[model samples]
Target: TFLDAVSRARPEIGDYPFTTIHPNVGVVQTKDGRSFILADLPGLIEGASTGKGLGHQFLKHIERCRVILHVIDMGSSEGRDPLEDYEIINNELKDYQMRLLERPQIVVANKMDLDNAKENLERFKKKYPDVEVFETTTIIHEGLDPVLRKAADLLATTPTFPIMDDEGTESSVLYTFEEKRPEIEVTQVEDHVWQVTGTKIERVFNINKLNTEEDFYLFADRMRYMGIDAALREAGCMDGDTVQLCGFEFEFIEN
Candidate 1:
């Protein structure tokens, strides 16, 4: 049983160059009221064992995970053979952590609704007979509930560990709210309009709908206070230029 089966997990906060250390960890809460962290480590590549790509960083994050959800793009739109892609990732993980090779990994076949996905799935199964795969179409929202339930069940039975481990030292699980300072990268796209992106800004926009003047003001104030105004000025954004959020666009002006 896997407790959390997500296609893509990014850092809570990010800078110009993303790194192995995450700003904030992802958490999944089950019906029984238990919560488990879904840590997003760097992805494993073909030569990750030999310090290729971010393989070492990616393997370290899985060390604390009870189960591994190997998410694969089954559509083959990325222009690589699906089975080879899976094998490359699997080999990298094996090279980085031999113990991880023994851990239960659920093959999450994503992009199932694509035109060529079924053929790739068939090929994948033929090559890896022992793997258990779950199909999902993220865009259409199909085959998601069952995956969630399976993830919860797996987490319930999995053992836990400290995020930062000490050699041969036993530790216990505990929740700590050590506040993480947010890292946002703001680029000036035009005069008075700053192109802003980061986990903090996105989450704030997701939870706050600017239907009212007050909401819009709150959002504006946040941007100004976060030094987005300075970034916009540096980018030469004019007062009337258009700026955008999640999906909504707004005109730039001094409040």
Candidate 2:
């Protein structure tokens, strides 16, 4: 509901609670031509700093976010105090390895339509006088414009936090590739049965898999150019021998 209020990109909406397996993104462009991306990252429980309840799965995405819009249920619809929830989330951000609390954060008091929401909001304000919070009832699209504009303004000034410490910050590959395998391998698996195995052989077979004579000639010509015929003869493949390649059987012939 809040995501829809932010960008109006209406995705699936349900009342039941579910795990956010991955994040969803939406863009917001203010009237003054300033724009920023907002990601709906959920699943931050009490122990998110130590990787609990989809903690690491979601927190890793926070490293790149320059601003965090922490939405609190002021309505207490879930029977939890708003003040406690605020502290818990900020604590988790503080405990995270990336020092996430250092980023600019905008507090949101959501679900203002529910009962006791105003009372809880008063109590929350009394507890944290310095913190500025925007109130909203996302279900009905109430009190959303100020929040959107404020987020865009903050993004205009807030620089992105460095996710890595080393100089290899320019998209470096992580994995070391294995040594190259031969393109073609001609093996004598039996007395007269020769099995030709290789990635190129399989690719050729898969492409020219038709049973027509013209297709077979094109396939044989590709194999010849790749030196499979000479490799087979060197492996002691004789004329009239049964050659198997990618499960297709054909009799060998010496030209």
Candidate 3:
């Protein structure tokens, strides 16, 4: 219904740009003539914490939002329980980051025109007694005025939150260092052949795309700095041994 809102706000606009690659941003003008930047972020789903269905990318954007307008399908036209849907989405949000639950949220119980929508809404109200819900049916644009007004009012008082990695903020420095864990693994596949595996090593290997001799030397230098060279020697790897790392096999030359 974001597209509907946009079209009504600006009649000249023909269509909403729909894509998952990036967010759709538009200026939403309120009845009081105050405009707010409304971003239509990609829909999140269950298991978003472990990189499921847009994952951290979607949740990361939500961190910047001061007020979260949770649009729920009250009709449950897709056969899923509306309450369960709400819980699932909220759980995903909470699981991804506890701070997300702290955002001031206004639930928009949408599709009120559909059958059993009212009944489902009643159930939803009972489930979440304290949650503020705005009833709406975007098809007829009913109840949207109040929702937008409430959102704008809330936004007026709400402060903009910094993104997750806002290094300039004082809160970023409040960190506790823990014992570092082993990030790379070295194993002997054969007498003169060794295999190296780890997220950090593999990521560096893939990102560097060691296609040229210079690139390979740079990668080797990084590995040495990371102590992977010492690790290979400690693991019983000898000079001229074949070391397999991230699918790339190279001869080890001890210095």
Among the numbered candidates, top lDDT falls to 2
Distance from true location, Cα of 180 in model 1, Å = 39
lDDT string for model 2 (1-255, tens) is 577677855454222111111256788766677777888765365676775423564577889898999999999775667889799888888887586888889999999999899999999989899999999998887888889899988887898788854543476677878676566888787677677767777666556534344545666677778888888889998876766665334567776
| Root-mean-square deviation of Cα positions for candidate 1 versus the true structure, in angstroms | 12.2
Residue 118 lDDT, candidate 1, scale 0-100? 98
Whichever of 2 and 3 has more TM-score, that candidate is: 2
Per-residue accuracy of model 3 over 1-255 as CA lDDT, tens digit each: 554564343212111110011345567777777777776665555566665423665677788788888888899765558898789888988887737888788899989999999999999889789988999988887888787788889899987665664444474454768565447989897677677777677667556643344555576678888888899889998876766664334567765
- In model 2, how large is the Cα lDDT of residue 57? 49
Q: Which consecutive 10 residues in model 3 have the weakest lDDT in total?
A: 12-21
Q: TM-scores of the models, in the given order?
A: 0.53, 0.60, 0.59
How are the candidates ranked when ordered by lDDT, highest leading? 2, 3, 1
- Candidate 1 per-residue C-alpha lDDT over 1-255 given as tens digits, one digit per residue, 9 for 90 to 100: 121244333432222111122213566654555555665443444565764323454466577677776778899764557888788878776776546766567678888888999999998888878877889876676676555667777776766644554566576896869456355656655444445556677666567544344555676667777776666666676665655443233456644
| Clashes per model (N, Cα, C within 3 A) | 13, 0, 0
